[model samples]
Target: MTKILIIGATGMTGKSLVAEALSNGFSVVANGRNKEKLNALKSEFSGIEVFNKDAFDLVKTDFEGIDVIIDAFATSPDQAYLQIDLAAHLIALLRNTTIRIGFILGAGSLYTDESKTQLTNDLIASDESTKPWRATPENQVYELEFLRHVKNVNWFGVSPGSNYIPGKKADNILVGNDVLLVNEQNVSVTTADTMAFKVIEEIKNNNHNQTRFTVANG
Candidate 1:
């Protein structure tokens, strides 16, 4: 069985990924900063091993037997740069190794139209209400740019659609590369379980290795 390690396993996306991974019969190692949440996850999923520590504190030894590490790390808009920092840190740690790392990114990094206009640029031109969380997509774009230049590590990235809500899996899924995805109703949203399902499917197939892709509910 592949031993998958999930960083930030207590968050919405991370927790859903954990449940999906276990449901697929893979051994899971969950890492998170909150002790209480880690205990709760461990209790909820008796098959998982919990690592209670900051993601930055994780060392190579901790991943000795892990097959893949999925980075679902998230932070406040004010400190969104940590997303890039953490991606760099993980890339540096896994350089020249066989371990594959996956990242959950924002759709802002994706292009939205025929002119190839980035969603981040569109967000920047939107109303002031988006200002509070604008830094997140901006930094996530930076994170993907940084990952694109990395040649040694095995990395993959997945971006959710405009509305990333917390919920169970959707009945259908749409996958895209670079361009934003929308369903028949012209809705661009992805539930936590749908994202998790795509992620685990990617891990099993390795179809998007060394690249990034986007997903949406269909």
Candidate 2:
């Protein structure tokens, strides 16, 4: 079985991904800053390993024998630069390591068209509406740059659908390169479950290496 490490495993999407990984028979090492929540998850999923640590502090020692690392942490939007710095730090630590890295990116940075940039704010108005997600900084751009400069590491940034929320898996997902993929109705969304499913699919297939891709339900 492949051993995988998940950063920010207590978050909304992260929690779902952890459950999915366990269900798919992957040995999972899940991380979170909150000990209580992390412990709760551990209790909920008796088979999975759990760690409480900050993202910037993660080391190969914490991931010994791990085959892959998934980053699901989100920095505060007011400190967007922190996300970039964290990516750089993570790349530095994983530079010579054998573990592959996968980032759970925010939809804010996805472009709706080749010439037009359609960020997350474009879809949702008012900070009150996007309060929860908007508080988290997005680094789709910097994450890609880090991958380009970092050698000996295979990395991928997976952006959720434009309107990600908790729901049943639609299984109607569209996958694409740098450009954001949306449905014919010009709206896109994916359930936390489907996003987890897609991530595992990419990990298993080793697809979209050193690149970023957007996913959405069709």
Best by lDDT: 1
Question: Model 2: clashing residue pairs?
Answer: none
Put down candidate 1 lDDT per residue, 19-135, tens digits, no spaces.
999999999999999999999999999999999989998888988999999999999999999999999989989999999999999988888754685564476648688888898
For each candidate, give its TM-score against the true structure: 0.97, 0.86
Name the top TM-score candidate. 1
lDDT of 2 by residue, 44-88 (tens): 889989888888887767777899889877656677676777778
Q: After superposition, how far is residue 135 of candidate 2 from its true place, in Å?
A: 7.7
What's the distance in Å from true for residue 106, model 2?
A: 1.8
Residue 191, candidate 2: alpha-carbon lDDT: 79
